[model samples]
Target: MGRSPCCDKVGLKKGPWTPEEDQKLLAYIEEHGHGSWRALPAKAGLERCGKSCRLRWTNYLRPDIKRGKFSMQEEQTIIQLHALLGNRWSAIATHLPKRTDNEIKNYWNTHLKKRLDKMGIDPVTHKPKNDAILSNEGHSKSASNLSHMAQWESARLEAEARLVRESKLRTSHSSSPSLQHSLIGTSASSSSSSAPVLPSSTRYLDHAWNNGSSTSTVATRMSDLESPTSTLSENNVPPIMTSVIEFVGSSERGMVKEEGEREWNKGFQESTTHLGEYKDGMENSMPFTSSLHELTVTMATTWGSSTTSAHAHGHVSEDGFTNLLLNSNSDHRSLSSEGGGDSNNNCHGNSSDGGNGTGNELYEDNKIYWNNILNLMNCSSPSDSPMF
Candidate 1:
């Protein structure tokens, strides 16, 4: 079959939209959403084609669209994301909430591109002009790593976009007109102009590390934007999300994977602050695959029984998953391994527990196991990231 045109262009307005046109488009969308962008113009009483109406609304009239100059942080993010993503503007736009892909494309063409040229940097490769002289092996290795990370990020963004698209569809059908208007209004006003408010699907991704919505030290559950009473949540639409681990005091202390497991376990046991308790409310937060969910349950049970000392010392670590994995009494096994029968030996084989040779081997194995899990969570898995 041949491709279809976005909209019939005949006899439709093509010039810049006036204030009245913008108001009409915004009001209609705020009330009914731009449900079927191909049909929005006729319903909204605009003379423009649906394609024009969609572009107008998304690029300019949308309440959440941030207007005017980009900040330094945003510029750095754009440059970094561009270096990784090349010219995939929509993918880059996912990282930069509220900023349109069109705006980013334009800004790059006009400003950032010139700035890089002046500095003798190749905008395409995001490298210095003389980078050709650098060692091929080093450059290739770095490029390979960057490409891998970019692929991982790109796949994740696509998944999030798909889930959000589905959620929006369900929301459009279920939400009342009055509720939709209030949601866009609250979303527009409540967010401090500096902070980005993630769309509903972002709850599937790690909010702090990926989205960075909140500035407060305490990492809270999906904000008012995810509240059931909010516009998006009208009619009891379950948060069509599965991830979003909260990272409290994440910036204050860096997570060092190389640290001895026993040492870190001690620190976790001694810490007074308790955070990320998985309660009934969190039943829907993770919604892991059935196998992984069962594994989590097993791990959590083992950790609970063994953490009597942790309770005596005070509170535990920041998150339930962290606490479980960090303090599990059973021997650590790779996630690929199903049953725990063979790997019953503790990874934290203390010097006194097994003397020198065996203890060192177990210790090394423990580090590798932790590294593998951490890398898997942060890189391989799309649904979760290490939250600490």
Candidate 2:
């Protein structure tokens, strides 16, 4: 079959569209409207191809195009849309009426995506890009999924921490109470030890996650997070998200803040007090992913054996946080291994603890072994659960 007509570069000029070319294209469209983009270039007396002409008109010369710095509202829309749709700029552009897909794509690549990376977030998954999380997944399906969600939560905290630092800097220079208030998101009367809550958009992502919404639904919820003001109030932040955010987002990130001010030579005691204690043991290990899924399961399951369960699998770190270390580091093997795919296949022939065990007991032991390590973190929910 012949190549698609669109891709065939026959005799069309392909390069920057000059002012004269733009004028000719614009004049043709203005006089008789853009009938068909593929045929419009030829009719407009331009040497450019249809794709080039279409891009030039839509991105630059369109009568409805809004040319200037993007307002905060537009920015939020773009962030929310990009989160839901990934790189589908054309679809993202439909809701953003005066903007072109090309414009939104460029803005994302040049701006928001970069900021997310600086904040330790993976722009594609909207999750943390830490190798520890990926390596920890190993080959277990349940552990892998939980670890992925944990990664998302971690990424969120990381981004929020950056925002808090930025907000602190912004507040230091400007006396605008309202701008400061919006950025702070919580009352000054709140406990100084409390972590700063996430922005409305972050909270919205959490909401979408909790509800198990699809991409389309995620886009819809993004619209609900909108407000006439660029800065959303703390009232808009959900309690579940805030309770967790205040802890994880504030503590470790404080270490970075203190380092950013090292010229003063602040002591460790002063840093912990100004921030929160960095008791990042196994559970507090990275201050993010270690305890999420496991803790959530613990809170949702039986609670009477919490202490016994803790002792069964994990050890206590110096900081007193249970360093479960994602099922005590036994669930995962390094994916880099040649036989990483089935690391345990040979183990099926081995006998049980007593060596003379029958098949029934071995079956139950196998079942329990794979269910999960020990799940007895004493807490009420993901936010309140004891670290790891």
lDDT (Cα, tens digit) per residue for candidate 2, span 258-364: 13223222321221121121122122222122222224322212111222343232322222222333232222212111122233322211111111212232223
Off by over 4 Å in 2: 4-10, 131-388
TM-score of 2: 0.38
Tell me how many clashing residue pairs each candidate has: 0, 1
Residue 221 in model 1: lDDT:
34
Task: Name the best candidate (by TM-score).
Answer: 1
Task: State candidate 1's TM-score.
Answer: 0.50
Against the true structure, what is each candidate's TM-score? 0.50, 0.38
Indicate the residue-level lDDT of 111 in model 2.
77
Q: Could you tell me how far off, in angstroms, the CA of residue 175 lies in candidate 1 after the best superposition? A: 1.6
